[model samples]
Target: MESLIKKLSKSHKDCPECPSPKVVHSFFESILGLLFPDFATELLKEEDQISEKIEELRHKLSRILIRNKHLHDGDGAEIAHLFFLKLENVYDLLIQDVQAMYDGDPAAKSLTEIIRCYPGFYAVAAYRIAHLLHSLGVNLIPRMITEYAHSKTGVDIHPAAKIGERFCIDHGTGVVIGETTEIGNCVKIYQGVTLGALSIEKADADKKRHPTIEDYVVIYAGATILGGDTIIGHHSIIGGNVWLTKSVPAKSKIYYQAKMYNPASDETDTYIIKSEG
Candidate 1:
């Protein structure tokens, strides 16, 4: 017990001070609350109150960066200032995302409902915010924010992934977007979809390991598109339960067909891809 205690003490002493999980979650929630009326704890009555809240958020981010100062470059205050300067652009991108979700899904009743209740919106919002921080070279906290969304929404998106404008995720559970994944605009991905790497090799860590999804592509549920070289062309439809690792041309339709099995030839599998080209 004494040896274990001493080991734990040494580990604690060696670790650098970073923002706590609660602080990271609070920071994310605060940003959401500030941006949309649906998530706000209480509406700011005046313009001055809104400005003060924004400043408070900036201060919180600065303090978070300051705590893990060694993990990044430049002054924390300067980084925080730069982040705020670019925040409007982020808000604009999220607005586009919200529009995409509302336009794509028939079940969505209104814009406010998407903002308030959709897990896909929550997950993508976390990604956009974390992606901004990642761009500014703030390391650990960005990951924390994305992970918080992942834990709650079951929509796992890496902060470093490049997602284009008007992207949508429907029935978002079990969606995985990898670190190096690149997604284009007007793309809709359904539940149980994986944009992942073919290999988990450490040597490929620096390389683009995930697939590239072109614009206007709709990848339905249970579709697995893997490999860095794999690219799904624009305006294509990738159907459910389809597994793809090779590149397909534009306007392609990839799906499986359940054929009647041969009773005499010892073939048991009934499902086959009628055309995966």
Candidate 2:
């Protein structure tokens, strides 16, 4: 046991370049606080204090870049400034997402409820922020932020995914949006949905692997759509538990026809349980 401990301690000492997870998490929290000041406290209610909050955000981001030595190749202050320049745009997108959730789900009571409690909203907000960092060519930090969101929300959205405006993720748990997945505006997806690739070959890493979901598409829970060429066309409805590998045309409704069994007659029956077009 002593020898094992010594070896483990040696391994830890050797890897001094590893980024601290605690610092990453703290940075993410700071970003969230800046974005939604009402999230943690009522301290941001006054309109006059907005500039102070922005400066605080800028300082925190600068500190984060300094702490993570491997990700400090460029001007940290400049990057922070650039990020804040698009802060209003990010907030606008988040508002649209919240509105999408409220409009799509009949169970949603108010925008306030969705903003305060919805895990999907939380995940989407994190994704938008992380995606901005990714687009700006900032390394490591984007993945860290998104992974933190995934850990909290069970929604695994790769920072590289291209998702459009008003995208709604209902229930969100077990939802996986791959790196190359492209989702269009007003698309709504439920829990246990995988917009994933059919293959995970190392050679296919640079290629488009995940499916494309066009505008106004609704993918129900447990639907798995795979392959790069697979596209769910505009205004389509994908039913629950359906596995799709090929492309579907616009205005299409795809569903699985389940078989029903009865014990009394020793006979099997097949029926279309759900349908919508």
Candidate 3:
């Protein structure tokens, strides 16, 4: 047992200190608290004390980055300051998302309700934050932040996915957005939707593996769109449970037409399905 303990200690000493998932999550929570002060009773209101909140957030971020060895003291401070400077733009995008959610869902009572109660909004907020970090070339932390949101919401969005403004994910549980997935603006996706790769090979690592979703496309629940070159064109409606690997043209409507079996009728036939376009 003593020998085993010594081996473990040696291994521990050899490994570099990775960023603590707990600490990263705490930082994520702190950022969210600043973004939505009303979510937490003790959080300082952004409107009331913007400068103080920014400073506190910047300090916390700098500490995390420095501790993780991702950046030097000066670099960490500069990055944190720059990130906060972009916070207003992020806030605006989040508001657009909230509005999109409210407009897309009939059950949504108001923008405030969407902001406060929607899991989709929560996931989007996390993704937006993570994506910003990813764009800034911050490693590991972005994935950690998105993974935290995935744990909470069951919406797995890779930080590297290029998502546009006004993106709406309704009933977002089981929604998986791949690293190379490129989604356009005004895209509405339902639960169990996967914008994924056809191949999971190691050689395909740097390639565009996931599909591209064009603007105004409505992807329904349980739809799996695969392959990097596969593009769901603008104004397309992909129906629930549809499995697609090929690209569709603009204004296309693709749906799975299951054959119906009427026991009394004694007629078993499948009809041709056509795109609305």
Candidate 4:
């Protein structure tokens, strides 16, 4: 009986195909070494000269930040150190995403595929890097990183946004998540989805400036959810190409339809309201 139990409890050891876990750490170190060469070299002895080039770029950036007053009450050396530390956290978050993508999606057959082919991964990676700079008060650099991701993936996620675990962004293109947006765990968002602010010109910077999405919500492609006060209830489904600004009830469905109108005749034709709920 004991032998049978042991056999039952034994785990299968499969072939390791992807290096998603290690890649993020190594890439983070590489990016950091490229960003602050002297510091990276000093910290990591017997390093490549790539660290030196990083230091050169950092020196130029420090001067620019000082000139532009982007940093407050911190010296160039201190800012650089803080930025690196923040980036380290961001790198950890990115690794979490890599793990999530690897474990959750069957299509992610390998770590290499995830790193090279997944736009969602790239967008999240850029956001992680940018968020570090944002927290470090390196205003311009964070935006630049996020913007680069946006340009490449068509996914514009601001660095200041707070996102929870098991979040999946599918087909990532044309997805925009604003700075103040708060996303909960196990949320899935598709391409062309926008969690944006209704009042881009509003004066409420401290107040909520974007939508709050709860857990287990699925936002379909081309769905635009706007407003600071908008709250998407848990387990809700937002249909594709729908425009929404108001709060949605839990376990609800939403959609949109258009009808042709003639100004001269003052008549409407083929009015349609498409919805499952």
Model 4 vs truth, CA RMSD: 18.8
Q: How close is candidate 2 to the true structure, as a TM-score?
A: 0.87
lDDT of each model, Cα atoms only?
0.92, 0.87, 0.87, 0.72
Please write out the lDDT profile of model 3 over residues 1-277, one tens digit for every residue.
9999999999887655666789789888878877876464475545657677678778988777766654333466667777887878778888899899999999999888898889999999999988887776678899999999999999999999999999899989999999999999999999999999999999999999999999999999999999999998999999998888899999999987878878799878664445778
TM-score winner among the candidates? 1
Cα lDDT tens digits, model 4, 164-265, are 876778789989999899998778898999999888675677778799999888999999999988998888889898888888878878776667788898
Q: What C-alpha lDDT, on a 0 to 100 scale, does residue 91 get in candidate 1?
A: 96
Off by over 4 Å in 4: 1-68, 71-73, 202-206, 256-277
How would you encode candidate 1's per-residue C-alpha lDDT over 89-150 as one tens digit per residue?
99999999999999998999999989988999999999999999999998888899999999
Model 3 is weakest, by summed lDDT over 10 consecutive residues, at: 67-76
CA displacement after TM-score superposition, residue 9 of candidate 3 (Å): 2.1
Which segments of model 3 are wrong by more than 4 Å? 14-16, 43-48, 70-74, 260-273
Error of 2 at 250 (Å): 1.2
Residue 103 CA error for candidate 3 (Å)? Answer: 0.4
Local accuracy of candidate 2 as per-residue lDDT tens digits, 82-117? 888987888899889999999988999999889888
Q: Tell me how far candidate 1 lies from the true structure as C-alpha RMSD in angstroms.
A: 1.6
Quick one: ranking by lDDT, best first? 1, 3, 2, 4
Best by lDDT: 1
Q: How many backbone clashes does candidate 4 have?
A: 3
